[model samples]
Structures are given as structure tokens and as C-alpha cells.
Target: MKTSSRLEKAIKKLYVAFHANELNPECCKHCAVGNILNNTDSWKHLSNDHGSLELNYVGKVHQTLGRKFNGYSPLELLQIEATFLKACGYQLPLHHKNKKPKSSADKEALFNGLTAVMEYLCKLDNINNIMDYSKLFEFENEKPKYQLPY
Candidate 1:
């Protein structure tokens, strides 16, 4: 599937961050949107609260002005961060009293989070989920229902 240049770059950056153990849903500079924006914490200013999809005044102005950070709008960035945090076992609008993962470095949790983020990214690009494996289960009359084009 052909992906937009922005989507391609975002996926490559996220892949490296995931493998390098740099992805952290709680850190402004290491979250999904952060990594997609080159690990900068600037995106955090888009929202008054971390993991919030609602844009603040500054964010609203940017959104109205058609500003995009790394090909994503302020609201889109917030949504991406929220998606990552939720999949990483964090409750919405993260707070000190909110439920969280037992360990910060849980590989399974991180993998799940990344998978979810990747799916969301693909969805934003209007493409098939690259991580989908459901086709492997497709069968007809004891034969594979689908064949790999490659």
C-alpha cells in the first residue's frame, strides 16, 4: 500500500523509538506525538493537559491557521498521544491518582501501545492496517483464501 510521505516518516521514526526503548506515554518528549515530531516537547503546548484531545487557545489558533506539526494538526497530535497512553494502560487525562501500569518498562504493554498507535496512524492515512494478521486465518476448503502478491 502506498502511504503518504508524512505517514512513512512517522512510521519510521516510531519504529526506531519502539526498538530503542524510547517510547514513553507519560513523557512529553518521548510519547507517540513527540517521537513523530522528532522527540520535541513542543507539541505538548498544543493542549493544556497531556493526553487531552481538546485543544487549548494556542492550539485552537494554530488549528484555525492551518498549522501542522510534522503533518499532524494540534488536535490530531493530542489524539495520537491519548491513543498511545490509553493503550499503554493509562487512564484518560492522566493524573497521579489514575490507574497505571505496574511497571514503566513492561514490554508487552509497550508493544500493545505501539500496535494500537500504528493502527491509528494507518487509519489516519486511510490505509489498511499494516500490522493486521487476520488474513492468515482466512481459509476456504482447507486452502488459504488469500495469496501473497509478493
Candidate 2:
């Protein structure tokens, strides 16, 4: 199935953020993107088997976005990765940190990339505003509290 152009653009923007090492948030255990990037097993397999990290990331993104938008095929994911990587001028194995943006350009790229991801997420959830994506994060963070049997 063909994804929308807007979704494609969002993916490209996210790839740029990933390439720039600007997407790692504090406590990757709570961040979808961070989990994919820091997966040692996946990286090891990728190195040994010549596997595609891009596909791995896309699969994680698809799962995180939920079953409502789980129609992407491996070929479509590869195409998205190819388009993004082709415009990148760096090598793989991106190194990320939690430091602030070093410059205006860095800040701009980060903002654009984050907005793109949020936009795509909102579309998936049928939300009207990008900011609404934050609610999803909040919901995820709020696991059901356990209590002693009354």
C-alpha cells in the first residue's frame, strides 16, 4: 500500500534527525525511537548478516504507531529508508546524546524532524493537531496503578 506524501516527508525528516544524532531522548526505555537505535541485538545482527537497520526502525515505528496503520510492506519501508539515506552525507552507526542543539541549523533540523514525527503520529491516530500526539505519550506513561486486593 502506498503511503501518503505527507507521511513520506515525515519519514524523511525523521531520518535526518536520526542521521544527525539528534533524536535520542533521556531514558530510551520510554522513547520509541531510542529503543530501536540502541538495540544491541539488532545492531549485532545487522553487522553480521548485512541486515537493514532502517527496516528495523520502520517496523518499530509501525508497531508503536499501532495496528491502525500497519499496512506497510518491507519494500515500502526500504524505499523510505533509501530516500532518506541517499540525501544523508554521513556514515552509519549514529551516535546520539542528550545535549542541547549546538547551533541554529541543528535546532531547526531537530524541530522539523520532531514535528514531522508528531504529524505522522497524529494522522495515524486521526488527531487534528500535531500537539495532540503528546496525549498519546502521556497515556503510554500512565500505566494502570497496582493496588492490594480490597
Candidate 3:
């Protein structure tokens, strides 16, 4: 199925953010942006299997975007993410693993890249005024829910 123009625009913005070095993969490992970039290398290789990873990433995006844009269910978000991945020549696998060592720089890159895409999405959905995406840069006094136990 063809993706909506809004989703397409969001995907394109993600690519632009990545190439512009706006994402930080390491810091955003658990974020939608970080997950997509880290899992698929910015969608460069079609062979990289995402499996449930796609759902996980898109779900994360939905958690934030959903608050702003109503009517989109989690399943719908998953479908959108899957469509986006397929358009980029990637597929969602049932299972997979990352054998390579984790790279902080790569993580940071993805995180930053996703942030830009998300910001654009918020603006597109008219949620920018409600939630300041820039707050992502601020260090919260409380630990983030996604913070690693280790």
C-alpha cells in the first residue's frame, strides 16, 4: 500500500536529519529515531532484518506523536512504519540479532536524526506548541522512563 503524503514527508525529513548529523544514536537507543537508524543503518541495506523492531520503533513514535495527533491507533502506526521501511527497501523480520559491537557515535547520530524528524512531525500535526520538542535537549531532574537499568 502507498504511504500517505504526511508519512512520506516525515520519512524524507528523517533522512535529511540523519545526513545533517542531527541525530545521536547512542543517546536515543530506545527512541524511535535511534531504533530505526541503528537497526537498519539509515535504511541503507535491504538485507537487515527488523522483525518486531519496526513495531517497537513506530510504537515509540506513536507514544509521542499520538498525544498530539488523535485517531491513529498503535496498529496503524505499525503499518505506517512497516510501509515506510518497505519503501526504503527493507523488511520486518520475525527475529534477528545485532552481532556487531555497539557504537556510541552511531547511536548519537540516529538519535539526533530522529529528533529532527519528530520535530517536523509535531509541527505537521500541530502539536509543536503543546509539546516543546526542544525539551529533549534539556537534562531532566528525574530519570527518563526509558533509561537503562544498567
Please report the candidate that would top lDDT against the real structure: 1
Question: In model 2, which regions exceed 4 Å deviation?
Answer: 1-32, 35-105, 132-150
Provide the overall lDDT of each model, using Cα atoms, as 2-decimal numbers: 0.88, 0.38, 0.40
| lDDT of model 1, residue 26 | 82
Alpha-carbon shift of residue 150 in model 1 (angstroms): 7.1
Please report, as a residue range, the 10-residue window in candidate 1 with the lowest summed lDDT: 103-112
Tens digits of lDDT, candidate 1, 1-150: 799898899989989998999988888888888899999999888888888888989999999999989999888888888988899999988787889999767889988888998899899999999899899889999999989878
lDDT (tens digit, per residue) of candidate 2 on 75-103: 33333222222222212232343223344
Q: Which stretches of candidate 1 lie over 4 Å from their true place?
A: 148-150
Sequence-dependent TM-score of model 1: 0.93
TM-scores of the candidates are 0.93, 0.30, 0.28
What lDDT does model 3 reach? 0.40
Better of 1 and 2 by TM-score: 1
Q: For residue 114, what is the lDDT in candidate 3?
A: 48
- Local error of candidate 2 at residue 87 (angstroms): 11
